[model samples]
Target: MLEVENLDLHYGQSRILYEVSFQAPKGQITTLIGNNGVGKTSTLKAIAGRHPASAGTITVDGTLVRLTTAFQAANAGIAYVPQGREVFPMMTVEENLETGFACLPKTDHHIPDHIYDLFPVLRDMKARRGGDLSGGQQ
Candidate 1:
């Protein structure tokens, strides 16, 4: 399970989140919903380690995580794909997939056939620029 408790986040001197708390059990998806600029994205950013929480704690499978950097978060199995799909607009589909290797060991860097199997369109458009694809495809 993933657990967040008493979470707080800030940008510079401005506080963005206050005492946020939630739990996402294993094998299930949890969605965060709120109107724009209501700290929803900030909450996810904190959990994903894209942005550090100023206070509070996060645990994955009962182990405390030090979400000090994006690499640490990725090692902890936390991936934050920001809204607007932060793919490099100039990169091809294959190159975009390669970017996921940043969180993986060198031995695990190759694209798995299963990925293409799961997203056949990606395989067909491997040479296409990310910006050329529809939002869902990206």
Candidate 2:
């Protein structure tokens, strides 16, 4: 499970989130629904470590996680797919996936079959350049 407790965030002096909190259980899809400028994206940014939370605790599976950088969030098994689909244009789809191995030891670097199972098209387009795929594929 992923938990955000008493999350507070700010952009300069304007407060984006005030004591926001939520829990996302494992193996389930959780979504944030709200009108524009209601801090939905801000809250996601805080959880994804794209922005710092002024005060709060983020925990994954009962372990507290420090969200200081994108890499830190990845280390905590948090994955964030940007809305703009920011994939390396020159790299193949498989190559992009392999980039995540940067934070892992060499022995654990290979992509597992489960990943391909979850998104079979990725397996078929593994050799295709990221920029060549449609937005949904990316």
Candidate 3:
């Protein structure tokens, strides 16, 4: 399980999040829904360690996580597909997906077959640069 409690965030004294709390259990989908500027992305950023929270507790798999960086969150099994589909524009489709292996240990550093199953088009365009793909294809 992943848990967040009393999360507060600020950008140099301009507060963004306030007392946010939630829980996501394994094998379930948890969606964060809100109007614009309601802290949805901020909350994900905080959990993904892109930004530090002013006050909060984040727990994963019954262990308290001290999220000091985005890599740490990835190591803790937190995968973030940031807004705007931030794929590497300069790299090929295969290269872009290969970037995800950075979070895994060497023994597990290969793309899984299920990924191709999920995005079948990627299999055909593995040699094509990400920038050449349309926004919808991305």
Candidate 4:
């Protein structure tokens, strides 16, 4: 469960968001749609702590977090896959996936089998260079 209320964000003196609010619960797909430069990505960046909110609050699992950094958000179970795939080109497929472990505890470092199920080709090409993969594959 997640909730964002009365969020405001800015870049220097340029304001990007104003009183933005939304909610998402487990087992549902909530989408944020808008025209270009309407603060969709800005709102997400605020929620994920990629961008700081000038005002307002974000609550996840009933805990209020004033997002100020990506590390804080990741520690609160907020995972963000940005619009552009920023996979490590030099790392193997397996190694790239292993990077996700940074957000998890040691007890959960292993890759989930279901992830492989979703991207079966990744399992087969685990040893290959990530840079060589097709854009779509990455």
> Which candidate number has the best TM-score?
1
Local distance difference test, candidate 1:
0.90
* Residue-by-residue lDDT tens digits, candidate 3, 5-108: 99999989799999999999999999999999999999999889989999989899999987877668889988788898788899999999888776778999
User: Candidate 3 — which residues are off by over 4 angstroms?
Assistant: none
What is each predicted model's overall lDDT from 0 to 1? 0.90, 0.90, 0.89, 0.89
**Tens digit of per-residue lDDT, candidate 4, span 2-70:** 999999999999998999988999889999999999999889998898988999989999999876666
Candidate with better TM-score, 1 vs 4: 1
Give each model a TM-score.
Answer: 0.89, 0.79, 0.86, 0.85
Give the Å shift of residue 69 in candidate 3: 3.2
Task: Compute the lDDT of residue 87 as modeled in candidate 2.
Answer: 95
Instruction: For candidate 2, write residues 9-111 as lDDT tens digits.
Output: 9999999898998999988999989998999888888889899989989899999887778878888888887757899999999999998887688999899
Better of 2 and 4 by lDDT: 2
In lDDT terms, how accurate is model 3?
Answer: 0.89
Instruction: Give the range of the ten consecutive residues with the poorest summed lDDT in model 1.
Output: 65-74
lDDT of 2: 0.90
Candidate 4: which stretches are off by over 4 Å? 68-71
Alpha-carbon deviation at 59 in model 1, angstroms: 0.7
